[model samples]
Target: MKINYLELKRVTAMHAHEIQQAVNHVVNSGWYLQGEAVGTFEAEYAKYCGAQHCVGCANGLDALTLTFRTLITLGRMGEGDEVIVPANTYIASILSVTENRLTPVLVEPRLNTFQIDDRLIEQAITPRTRAILVVNLYGRNALTDTIIRLCTKYNLQLVIDNAQGHGLSLPHGTLHSAALPSPSVVCHSFYPGKNLGALGDGGAITTDDETLATLFRTIANYGSSRKYVFDYCGRNSRLDEIQAAVLSVKLKYLDADNALRRNAAQRLIGEVSNPLITMPSAEYCHDNVFHIFPVLVKSPDTLQRHLQDHGIGTMRHYPIPPHQQACYQAWAALHLPITEQIHREEVSIPCNQTLTTEELTHIIFAMNSYDK
Candidate 1:
């Protein structure tokens, strides 16, 4: 009755044959970097996201970094300009901002949804604020109508950190107006464990702006637009051919896999009831792809140990708030109670497409039976 938090091996096994074939094709093709495979995945992924362009990079952080860097090069934003971000998200989200010499205005997230509070964003906007980097934390849609309207009214650039939320769609009939920035960008990551994972690290940025896409590709390729001709100071961050080929295969099953994740998550939400455990609000659950099915408890360490004893596994989505991290010591004094609380209490249980029905039942039973 052993249930690991997320067995990537089993997940990979589901498509091993196709993945192997794709990788083999790449190895035999004699061209790895910037080849047909990369081009094909980029176009397919862009179409999947309803964007016109997709620029592949080495990893998720690079995707975020290059997006802002490209925006700066286009004069859409510049150094020291502020980008609003969630205080509770993984450090990579904030790192993307600081790495570009841009300031990150950390806003707390709603405890129920574990998403950046759209209500708090407007108040955080100041003259220096240039963009809103919305992270779809834990595969949930973080974009709200309020945030979109604010972005429109203030003329701020909208950037989406979709590292955890691949295949999530905006609410029907949303984002169709001329007021919003044309070609709004969404960044994606294909780390080995993500919903739309590759065998190795990979990422891409999707946008309708041809200029931004070209610049992103150039920046990721050591700032070279043409052969040996450097445009702007950039670095090597191109998605390799094998990973791109693998991703192209996985992309076809993403929606179906996400639906399976949703089914498992819904069962957990509806069935798990414990005084010591608090589940996320169901309001966003239907829309969420359930990258991580998180729960709050009084003692996450104790719960983790308890689950381990039961041969069940668990992980913390995060245990430290970004603001509290020592790297940003200047902001150490900032008090964000909600964000701190989430970091202290959150634990992610198994909720991937790889879990079996028996395993899922065991998880719910183990959770409900816990007296500690």
Candidate 2:
């Protein structure tokens, strides 16, 4: 009766065969760095996202940082420019804006969806505002259409931080971003446990702009295109051949796996109705892959204790909002009542794609039994 939040999909014998084939091919190919495997993986991933191009990287944080740096390289943004972001997002979201020496303006997210409150974005815009870094928290997509409209109105870039939302869009994000160009970017994290997770950390930036995509590649590879020539000071952040190969195989099943996660989430909502627990409502959003089933509950401490004692594993998406953290305190004075409340009550339940019906029921029963 012990279950961690999620178990990675089994690398069954067949999966292992594919991985072994890839590994053996890589082993003798003598072309590991930026080789055929990397190139093939990039092409396949781009096709998967419906984007014109995809550049793989070492990790999610690097993917986010490269997106920001690429904007600056294209002269779309620069130092002293400001990037608007959600206060309730993962720290990596904020770090990306700051890593590029740009200012980060934190805005409160909707309590229900935990996405940046679209209503408050326009008012936060100033002359220096260059882009909006919107995150699809847990598994939900933000009101990206509304965000696109606002970006158009303000002439700002829309950099999507989809660390927790990989196969999240399936096909929608590419189509949506393709509808508009030069002001939109959708980045994905293939970190382990993600909808498109590799065996290790990885990520990609999807965009229709060939120029921006080109620049992102340069940034991810030490600012050099020809190995010896350096375009600018960039970081070493290339996605490994082994990971890329593994990801190619995983990408094939992402959609079906996401559907499984979604189904489990629906059942959890249907079964859990304690007045103390608040389940996320997707009425306002589009698609979700349930990266985490975060719910609000009274006495988070007692709930965590009770669940843990009963062999049910649970955790907080974030116990503290980013703006309140000490490193970000210089500009953290902004009041975000909704964000604060979310931090206090939010607790993530076990909703991994690999979860079985019996396992899921065990968790639901434990949560419900707490009331009695």
Candidate 3:
């Protein structure tokens, strides 16, 4: 039985009829850009995320860049200010920071959770630090009490890159309360493969601050708050109409789909007992939506080849650490042991709402059967 890593075609087919109808409506309406569809989706998504406002954008990277840029415009942060980010995260996260001329202070993630180590954040904090940008990598909740407390103690802005964590609820009680400040914002990506995906590239920012929300919307729309009125030097990054309508349909099922992903991840965590394979801690399994079911092995390439031989496909969440990339050669001398180790050993298995029971069982069998 051949099982692909993630079959987006199969996933889309689950609601193809509704998606088609939504697209047809847009095509016939003679409106495509900023229209009623985008407005409606922004409202629905804002409610779903429990935020007061949502600003749709062109893509995830734009969502992140716009948020930081808005903060700078508000005089809350500025160029040369530092933003703490996870060292093991995708390059896009760091790029958003550097794009605005803000310095990115890379902190290593804990090997166990594959998230930024909160314990190390405070020590990395210097007087120049103005924000804490926590990435919810692999759909895990990166927000912790320590991280929140540090932000509060130091009066730093809080930014969340929820590109992979669409349906993950903020932890209950204090963790949730502490996670949001007046300047706090959550950035989302509705890429084709995400839990809350659209047919094409899409993204949004959720924030309770009305001022910031309005500013983000303006900056994403060619820096125009009104027609022929240019407030800030912005670029065109609107979400468009068709993608918004499609996202509205998918948004209804996001919670249910996330539950399915969690169920599959739980099965893998409970059943896989290979000594060489290190599964994520079961305690935090439910805390994530399981966008990517990752495991650590000494030889990821060998395991990948073994899985491929068995007609099972796998991928690496990331093969190279951002610090080691050629673009950031200036930081090549920085030694990040844990971040480097995760990049070396991590392999992403096929886990999503599209997997069948039989396919999951086969994946389990293949993983347990690996001896090399």
Candidate 2 worst ten-residue window by lDDT: 170-179
RMSD (Å) per prediction: 1.4, 2.1, 1.3
| Backbone-clash count (model 2) | 0
- Candidate 1 residue 2 Cα shift, in angstroms, is 1.1
Candidates in order, TM-scores: namely 0.97, 0.94, 0.98
Q: Which residue ranges in model 1 land beyond 4 Å of their true spot? A: 173-180
Candidates' C-alpha lDDT: 0.90, 0.80, 0.90
- What does candidate 1's lDDT look like per residue over 9-95, in tens digits? 999899999999999999999999999999999988988887778889999999999899999999989999999999999899999
Residue pairs in collision within model 1: none
Distance from true location, Cα of 325 in model 1, Å: 0.8
**Where does candidate 3 clash, by residue pair?**
none
Q: Candidate 2 at 10: error in angstroms? A: 4.7
Candidate order by decreasing lDDT: 3, 1, 2
Residue 210, model 1: lDDT of 89
